[model samples]
Target: MNTILKQFLLVSSIYLFTPTVDAYSLNDSLTKGTAALSSATQVKGEAQQLVGQLQSQLGVSQAQAVGGTGAMLQLAKNQLGANTMSTLSGNATGLSSLLGGSSGLSKNLLSNISSMSGVQSAFSALGMDPAMIQQFLPIVLGFFGEQGVGSTLLGQLQSLWTPAK
Candidate 1:
């Protein structure tokens, strides 16, 4: 009976004294979540700066800016292909986010805008005239130029966005 009592006490003490192990603690989870949110905000801020420029310069709404810019980028991606677009995105911070991380509305609006006509349709959907594509070209090109995109890539984007005579 004494041995049984000793074993019981030992087991109880072991359980009571043992530290709990968690893969992710509440504090750790919160820290990681905060870090992720901060990173996302930075990316969004970069995108917002570009969008704001488009809106203010063109007198368009936020949706128009995002959709128009996204349409142009999608068209570029389609024309330049993924590898070249990757190079462009590498040179320009937040370009990838504009391409893939904008709001769901812009994504849905611009996802199919891989061709010139699609771009026009996207502009029409946003209540902007198709002629606005020309207006958006220089601003986007200038934005890329300011972002340190090389002249070669800028030339390619310009040619892609420009209509042939």
Candidate 2:
């Protein structure tokens, strides 16, 4: 039993103390991490710029800008199916943060937004005027479009949100 215990401790210590063989070198890992962080910072900066534009152009508060963006994105996600939404979320770095801190109404709409009334309710819950939604949708979505969110996705959103005029 003592010999068995000794063998176990020896194996355990060897496993614990050995250096891991990583696929990439330390310098390579640092370079990749730095690049990823830079990309994320750039995406976040662009998102902030859009939010600032929304606030300035629409005369809305910061909360309104964030909430409105969330509401609009949630509505689009509801319409476009999860796969497309996931792609958008993955590619658009700050998008997840914007969607995450939204009001309950916006988060609830993530699951279902089949009716116009439902859409209006979500926006209204964010304290947005119904009239403002018409103006707000285009700006938020257009920013995403400029950020390379894909023309196809933007087209679908435009079709859904735009009235039959």
Instruction: Report clash pairs, candidate 2.
Output: none
Model 2 lDDT tens row, 11-61: 999988876767347545534432332232222535677778898999986
lDDT tens string, model 1, 55-91? 8999987766766777788888887888877776776
Error of 2 at 101 (Å): 4.4
lDDT against true structure, model 1: 0.70
lDDT of 1 at 36: 34
Span of ten consecutive residues with least summed lDDT in model 2 = 34-43
lDDT of 1 at 1: 67
Q: What lDDT does the true structure give each of the candidates?
A: 0.70, 0.62
Best by lDDT: 1
- What would the TM-scores of all predictions be? 0.66, 0.60
